[model samples]
Target: MAFLGFESKVFMAPMAGITDAPWRTILAACGAGNLISEMAAINAIQRKNPKSWQIANVKDEPYPVVVQLVGNNPELFADAAKLVTDLGAYSIDINMGCPVKKIVNNHAGSALMCDLPLAAQIIEATIKATPLKVSVKFRKGWDNEHINAVEFAKMCENSGASYITVHGRTRAQGYAGVADWNIIGEVKSAVKIPVVGNGDIDSPQKAEQMLQQYEVDGVMLGRAMLGNPWLLHRTHHYLQTGEILSEPNASQIRQMLLKHLHLLVNYYGEHSGMAISRKHIGWYVKSMYDAKRFREQYTKLNTLSAAQDLINEYFLRIEA
Candidate 1:
């Protein structure tokens, strides 16, 4: 259950556009057990795509970072695994759980769930290519009609995957409906290696529930951590003390948002950083009063100063 030397069992999921180096560094400081990089396309990496390199960058993280790669080609996966390892990745995670249409159509991601033999071959190739521990993240199945997580977990374990993570839904379900924790439990029962449960776990209580009820070795959070890195800290604290902490107040949330903006600007440069900050800004104000108007105003931001000014104005209005 050791997660490449992480101290906690609450992990940040490898969300494609969200869990980049800047955000991972923030979560690590908040005591996230493990921080995974955004999904890196293996073909893009092999082609020396600059955007792929940017997303895969893990240089500043304090903890050993886990880089997740998505692709169906075994040779390309092997090559990408080695590249990330050379760039200082602590582990390589195969992306069999991504449900995006583009990825699935490419015969990658959740599509791999339909072809267990190829998935196993990819795992074996990546493991053989790198001395780093390799893992696989997959869904319950391709659809409700094909519930093969238990069988897939066994294949990954037998194929030399160090551990496995299972999202509770199938590809057909996408992010809709409730994630079936019972299926995660089934995978846990079917595998001897560590099993991490992902999906629908957004709070400390939910995290504890997954561990106590589903018996997973760990829990991975994705959408839940979008603008609430404090959830990671709160989950860890609750696990240690059996007491839930108060949610971050308006002031605290504002400060976190400001810090997030600064980090994004530092990492991605001002223009692109401000562009990317739009969605995060919206997430931060999602629960606030008149948030729709604020979001409409925020997405028009084209400069860092303009974004900062708008954020200050928004917080002032909340305080008023």
Candidate 2:
């Protein structure tokens, strides 16, 4: 069963400050399956925050977009679900596995994992509130000793969640250590619903291995996709045909970086856009010839043209 009618099995896990509209649109163009948006707070949506509304702005998006919501309040989540539905969200994903301190401090995010009753309420309320498909993203558990992914998977299924994505780390791990695909397999086994595995599937080979090893329904790529947009397409293609695709060469990288810069600038304006593109520029040129100094010079430039000139010259010098 395709979650939200997504035919492709490869998905993009939303990264805050990274999976904005421009980025999501780019990923859709790159041939990712259903795109999960950066998680926004249900409280902010209920309060009518412009930032929250901006995050839910998928009304005009050409690709299917799942607007993820995070909160401890089931009522607010119900309201936010309807609002996002009005904003054209293709589905909803509850953020039950965010391990950030501030979030858990407020009894939201992964904190909900420690309180399965409330988590169930949030999920069931969200599913009942929207005609759109509902999904949950969670971890192995709050900690190692409290490992309860299998139990949580059963809870999600019983609460009527249409899909689930299991990131193979606990709240305590917070992205460190190797992700346990074994837990993902366990979750897949514990529930009959579609289970998508996340975490540590960095390369095409690893992504394929996750599918083959964990027996998951799909794979979601997160940090690995930073600056490596082609990964989604390459991984998807490799899974479909078993043929590895060529990595983008120097010229191709240059072209992609330049296009990404323009997209950022157009969406966020020059000053902020140039500032944001610095990290992306670094990611794109990671480990390339003289990239350290190149990144330093790029950061110092305030104007888009200066940044553009730097990117072009640096890439050209590397090619020469």
Backbone clash count for every predicted candidate, in the order shown = 0, 0
Please write out the lDDT profile of model 1 over residues 113-199, one tens digit for every residue: 899999989999999999999999999998989999999999999999998989999999999999999999999998889888999
Candidate 2 local lDDT, 1-320, one digit each (tens) = 24458867888897888988878767777675667788999999888898888888788888788899999999999999999999999889999999999999999999999998999999999988999999999999999899999999999999999989999999999989999999999999889999999998888899889989888999999999999888988888888889998998999899888889988898789998999899999999987988899999999988889988989999889888
Q: Which runs in model 1 stand beyond 4 Å of their true positions?
A: 1-4
Q: Cα miss at 310, model 2 (Å)?
A: 0.8
Residue 164 of model 2, lDDT score: 95
Residue pairs with backbone atoms closer than 3 Å in model 1 (clashes): none
**lDDT score at residue 119, model 2, on the 0-100 scale:** 95
Worst 10-residue lDDT window for candidate 1 reads: 1-10
